[model samples]
Target: MNKVTTIDLGSNSFRVLIYDCLNHKIINEYNEVVGMADGLNETGNISLEAQERVVDAIMRSSKSLEYDPKSAVCVTTAAMRLASNSNDVLKYFEKTTGARFKIIDGKEEARLTLLAVKYALKRERIDSSKFILLDIGGGSTEIILNEGDNFNSKSFNFGIVTLTQKYLTSNKLIEELDNWKKEINLFLDELDINLEDFTFVATAGTPTTIAAIKLGQDFFHYDKDEVNGTIVNLKDLDESLEMFKNSNNETITKLVGRGRVEFIEVGIYIYKAIFEVLEKNESIVLDDGLREGVAIDYCLNKSI
Candidate 1:
């Protein structure tokens, strides 16, 4: 079996996952939550600081992937796609490190996420209609209406860091979040989406963080088998929201994962809002997503 690595350079983090492509299984995964999106607001772009750090992280990983740097496909989403200076970032990374990173648009990101969900359900032999896939990214959230192996999708501007900086202005962030929730609900209501027909497949850092809290774990350790059909109470998420509001950023960084500390509460708001919109008090976390989707795409397409 051939080994191939996939790099998903997301707004909140940069992740590299190596897989036994033929066998369709993960071998090893490395990630760093650089909060690369931190200064996106100030510069109207992915910060030069982030670009330099990203280059260093990728170069570090490149040493380990020395066998075939060409086999590793690095791609960026949301933040890069939305940033004004994204082209410069891409060009610089490619020029300095010889790593060509593609900035995927919303539609392609949606397609990859859809592919991820499908691959997961097929591998596990679970019903495809079982859940609605939600990927809460740093710059955006990708929503896929999964129904019996076919899905309809949408990419929204709702993101944890963006929301935190934009709306988490007061203790009344929850109420303000309600307005955002209303938009989600209105969109779904317009579509007449069937809530009972679907379970929630929450992905990305935000959902994972909420899941970690629910399990009372302090780190990012979770088993897909343990979580597959499990559900998390919306009220538990609501409790977390209150917990975050009470704590300071420094405390949050100390307690929760590092990169997400400052915006964890904001993420909670988005997650809780989705729970409310779905009208289900609970959600299931899928630790597998995007990167897996990209790997599966490479495998099936023989991208290597």
Candidate 2:
């Protein structure tokens, strides 16, 4: 079988995913929270402690890649892009794990994200000529507006972790809500997206986690078949918001796990804001995106 793996060095977590292309099976998958963006905003760099943990996580994930470096494609996102010390961290990762880490800019991130969205739509046979493809990550959000083959994408600096750090986490939750609303609204309004006749698709952890909650469990059981084409209406999203409000860290942790527990509430709100501003009714959820896009490129012998 043709095996391909993609490592996602995210702001909040590090993940390694391997797929057996011939058999269309998942061979190996691993995830760990490293809190890469914990103090990113204040220092504009990946902290020493977080950098240490990131190196450790990458070394652990590299175990599967040692045998054949050609089998895996590893990439880092916003956390690295904005960090002043990112080059040092990347060099350390490469030296220790023998993995070449690539830093993708906003447009490249969008292109790859859209590639994954197009792949999912084709694979699942979901019909839509023009739609928005969105990925909500821990450090950044990649937004894609697709009108047939013509598409445009922008990467916003605010994501679950970053947004929470910037505006949220306080006793005055309502006040924080209004404060963040103005900030995120400005960005969305500036986009001037007219999605009135388009479908909205959401990928990455937040949307999937919201969809997973409907499964009625605290532990997230990642099933792409279940999450890939799921539709999340704003009404269901509102219920998620209320549930988070009544719950504490312990309760939220049980639902979405660590590093994600606190950020998810704000993540959901990001979705709400997007739909409200874009004037879209619902968002279609996809389990695959950036990682899958990398895998697809690797399997095709194409540049990733």
Candidate 3:
């Protein structure tokens, strides 16, 4: 059977996936949160520590997975795109890990992500004719509208990590909520599309984490099959937010994961704002994202 590997060097995490192309199944998967964008907003560049973390993650994951770096479809997103020293960082990563990475633009990122979401919907026997896909990442959020062959997408600069660094760390989370909502609303207004006409589907960590929580799964017991295709209601998200607010850091970490405790609240807040502005009460959550998309796209191009 033909096999392929994919690496998603995300702003908040690094994920590696091994796929059996012929069987259309995943062989193995690994993920680690390295906070690649931790101090990017303040410096406009990737910190040396973050760069070291990424290189270490890449080497370790590749070594343990026994995958060849040369053939892997490795992609980096918003953090790299916005980093002024991305070229230098990429060179350092290549020299240290022997993995070539591509910095995909927002449009390409949306396209690849949509590819994964469509495949997941098909596997779940759901119609994908019309839907609005929301991907809330660490450095940016992508809003994609798909109507048959027509597609429109936009990427917003604010996300969980950046927002947390800007507001939560500064003790302005509560005070800045309204301003954040207004900013998101302004972007939605620019879309000029009737959001109510499309089904709302969300991918990435935030929705999947919410789905996991709703399914009574914790970090140690997460089941992607149960999390994927799960319908998460706005009320459920609000309740989760309240619980997180009242709970301590350790408790939140047990549910979401180690590196997510600090950003979960900000992520949930962003999701709530999006749902409120779009009048979306519920969303279909999926675990499949850019990593899956990269593998699928690679297989397709190779005619595997």
Best by TM-score: 3
Error of 3 at 66 (Å): 1.2
Candidate-wise lDDT, in order: 0.75, 0.78, 0.89
Output the TM-score of candidate 2: 0.88
Q: Which stretches of candidate 3 lie over 4 Å from their true place?
A: 169-192
For 34-92, candidate 1 gives per-residue lDDT tens digits of 66777676677877778888888887777765534455787888888778988888888
Candidate 2, backbone clash total: 0
Q: Write the per-residue lDDT of candidate 2 for residues 9-126, one digit (tens) a residue.
A: 8889787778777765567777888889998989998998997898787766666444343345888899999999999988877776667789988887787778778878877899
**Backbone clashes, each candidate:** 1, 0, 0
Q: Candidate 3 on 1-304: residue-level lDDT in tens?
A: 6989999999998999998888778999999999999999799999999999998888888889998887788999999999999999999988877888999999989988998899899999888999999999999989888889778888888789988988744357655656766776777688777877899999999999999999999988999999989999999998998999899888899999999989998998888877876788999999999999888888888621
Check candidate 1 and list the clashing pairs: 234-281
Ranking by lDDT: 3, 2, 1
Better of 2 and 3 by lDDT: 3
**Candidate 1 Cα errors over 4 Å, as ranges:** 64-69, 122-125, 171-176, 220-229, 245-251
Best by lDDT: 3
Residue 292, model 2, lDDT: 68
List the RMSD of every prediction in angstroms: 2.6, 3.0, 2.1
